[model samples]
Target: MLPAPSSERWKPLRAGLVDMFYYDQEEFWFHDGRLLLRGNNGTGKSKVLALTLPFLLDGDLAPHRVEPDGDRQKRMEWNLLLGGKHPSPERLGYTWLEFGRRAADGSEEFRTIGCGLKAVAGRGIARHWFFITSQRPGAELRLLPDSRVPLTREKLREEIGSRGFVYDRAADYRRAVDEHLFGLGAHRYEALVNLLIQLRQPQLSKKPDEKLLSRALTEALPPLSPGLVTTVAEAFRGLDEERDALRSLADAQQAATDFLGHYRRYAKVAAKRKAAGPRLTQSRYEQLGRDLAAAEEAFTAAQQQLDEARGELTALEEQRAELEARRDALRADPAMRDAERLEQLRQDAERKEKAARDREDDRDRQASQVRKYDGRAGQAAHQAGTARDKLAEALREAADASADARCAQQHRTALA
Candidate 1:
């Protein structure tokens, strides 16, 4: 990731920050186990190193530990929220260091130590949690899920679930880091931190003081354990006998050295005379031995590969057979056939039900037509009855008119 630190074994491969300070995601690579920060004043060069180098290991977010100058005004919360510069009222961030070492066989082991900071505006640091994991960020792990999203404490815990531990207390975190990273006890780790702080003092480079420096160095050394002290005392009690044995061994070594110095001159001529005869044979033998070793190594590698391939083939064949058996069983199952038959029956029933509904609709339409015809027939009958009544009235009127006419004729003849 950042030009992979020098191939040389380095405990601290890189240090990084995610959503911490002015950095969204920033990684500082170490060259030959050292990192150099260069920038103008107030560029946070010191702050970056301070937050990562020893602070990540110390798990102390205190101002003194965070700022090299021990500035009391500088706070961890300010780094996260940027003292109101950030828009969010709350913030979460991480500062982590990746430690790695290469084994003799060229295999690599990594250990990561990080602290998650929760800062709330006006609330200082709301929470501080630390984690140590073997998972490497940007590789097996990612501290930020998105380009701009940092992991919260719970999210980090979930991500590192079972792979590592996240500690809420700084003491536990420090103890775990010391044990895992440095193999140091609490007192020794405290002394080492003190020494580091003293060495990192800004003024130490400007004005070197021999006496004060000596005193600080002395104070930083952890006291010897009682058991070690007792062992040393016991060793000294037998020192006189060891000294006599050492003197005798030294005398014998000197005599052998003297004898060998003379014997080398005689042996050198004899070896030159004799070695020429078997030189070619020895060379051929050595070459054959090397070739045999190479062949053996290749054979071993090929055998291992063959074994792996065979194992994979066997597993795949077994899986195929198992799948075939499952398929056959499913095909033979009576329940499956019954389910298919039931599905077909259901489809037929639905089709018949739909046909019945269509027939009912047709019948209802025909009934509506019959009702209309019956209403028309009733209106016609009413019209015919009215016409008959009119005709009867006209006939009665005609009869009455004829009678009136006869009466009028009689009256008229009399009036005439």
Candidate 2:
């Protein structure tokens, strides 16, 4: 197994085919960033590699780039239609390559890039679309709803949804894939694709043919950009012209250096002759430096005293501010007197309410006593009426007794 190209960056994880060529659905996984197909010719190894690698990256259905033998006769449409072996009049297929990398947090991330081809029996390639996605097919994502049937372009687009984009144009698809996978611009990625195609040729290392090897390398090598070449030539030309002027200036500088060397010797001798007077002046300067140092010490002491005084003044100012704040607070004490007056009024009102409640209780008791006396007076009036009725009956009985006795006496006299 080959070592991984890089540990941090994404590398090819697998290539897949869906209803393309002889594959219903298949995957070819890479081991350590490399995959080797070990099968005899006619087993569709080259076809598998051609469809997945440079073709998937570039979305180039050109026969030369899509085929290992550089055969212009072959077409991707034929692969999709299975070279007319199928009974259907139309067909669609997919070819994809998955790239993977280890994240910093030890998780796995993936990107899948592929092209969808639609082919008609006689109309060649009807339409094609390319897709790039972060979703991994056969796991989090599915390119085929059923095990055998591949997804259509519309379904694929819906399936990927916001996780990816479906590209209508090959150039746009190539740009997206290049930016996501290779981190290269269009021109450089094209060169890289060309190199990949050259390296993937069928007979790269089978035989010791120097001519073939030379041709492969020559084709794999990117052609020098004309603009870049011109820019480099102009830069070299300018440097070459400047080199002569630089050499002339260097010669003049050497002449000036020689003259300066002689003048320096003369200057040193004159400096020695002038040193005695300066020595006397240097002693005086030292004395002045000591005096200046003493003056600076005095100034620093005064500055310290001034700073201490300013600090004391700041404290006094803060104390004054606090005193003013207290005075302002004391000025608001009249409001407290008003609060006390309100409290007094509230207490008077509460006492008056208590007296009123006591008066109401006394009135209720008096009304209850009056009601009791009225009941006793009604009983006495009823007794008096009974007594008067008894007296009238007694008087009537007495009159009747007297009348009966007189009647008896009259009857006796008549009998005599």
Candidate 3:
């Protein structure tokens, strides 16, 4: 179904008719509501009032309207017999109605609705047709009548779909009329039928109160015994209640098709309880229990995996602590400290050995100087010895001179 549109998206999926196109393929037919059906008195006037219109519109033969064991009524249905007399066996009958449609601005436009019924292959029931789109056969039945403009068959479907609401094996043709043209609801079709039945002048028309409800309405009126009056009123009330119930049931199931779609959707069981109203299915409890069991098993397996991971993590933490303690002890070990201390001791020893070698070189230089000084001391000693010898020789010469002077003095003294 096409959803209702908004301001920006106001294109209606189905449009209303603007006016009636009196024009058909042949010529113009209708002017207004005046339709002349030529016939004699005993022909179909009584049948039209008593049988035909009710059959076409309502698909009902009211029990009150039926006579006692009439051979004709017993043999076959009045409407079905009419369809069997059609020229074609497959086509039970066809009906069409043209109506003026409303335009967007409230002006009149035109549209035609066509319907056909075909008998089911071997069954007594007839399947109705639906005109879903304004295409092909739809175009053939519905037309835009203008004298100058010629018609062309371009883009249109040859026929409607096979089945809609598949379980709804009704006179499908009637559904199209019920939904699009006229409806079978209290406000629409039934009310209209009541009015039509009222139109029959009581003096001429036979089979009054075709449905008990009609007579029931009148029974409560005029002067009557009190007990009888109460009974009549009760009957009228019951009849009204029954009619309302039937109308509500129709509204629930069939009438909402265009708006909410098929009846079966409403009858479905809900998948979840949280959802608003469409009740639950009765047969699937054991399957639901099996699903719950599978879910619980999956959850248990996940929980076990989590527990195992936690156990492995605890072992890993303990192992890491042991490794950390070992590393700290290695850092504090004697060998490691000794290795650093040994490097410092080696550097200090190398410095002390270099100083000792420098002291030994200085000693050797002083010894060589002492040897040179010793040689000079020996030369001075030799010179001193020579000087002493020269002094002694001079003293001796002086002594000898003194001795000769004394001898000369002695000789002079001897001459005196």
- TM-score top scorer: 2
lDDT of 3 by residue, 48-163 (tens): 33432333334333433321222244322333334355333332333333444455566544333433334433454355432333232234433333432222122112222231
The pairs that clash in candidate 1 are none
Candidate 1 per-residue lDDT, tens place, 1-416, comes to 11222334547888999998899899999886788889999999988978886788677788887788878899889988888999999999999999888756687878889999899998999988999887899977899886668888888888888778899998999888876777668887988887887677677667898887887687668788999999999899789779999999999999999999999998888656554434433344445445555545554554455455455545545655665575566557576568666576456545644554554454455445445544554544454455455544544443444343344344335325
Reference-based TM-score, model 1: 0.51
Between candidates 1 and 2, name the one with more favorable TM-score.
2
Estimate, for each residue in 1-416, the C-alpha lDDT of model 2 and write its tens digit. Answer: 11222347788988899888888889999998899999997899878888888888778888998998889999878898778897788888889989999877788778888888889988999999999888887976677666566788888988888888899898999988877766678788888888888887768767667898788878877889899999999999999999989999999999999999999998777656554444443444445445555545554554455455455545545655665575456446565357566476446545544544544454444444444444444444444444445444533443344343344344335325
Tell me which of candidates 1 and 3 scores higher on lDDT: 1
After superposition of all CA atoms, the RMSD between model 1 and the true structure is 58.9
Compute the lDDT of residue 40 as modeled in candidate 3: 88
lDDT, residue 287, candidate 1: 55
Q: After superposition, how far is residue 81 of candidate 2 from its true place, in Å?
A: 2.8
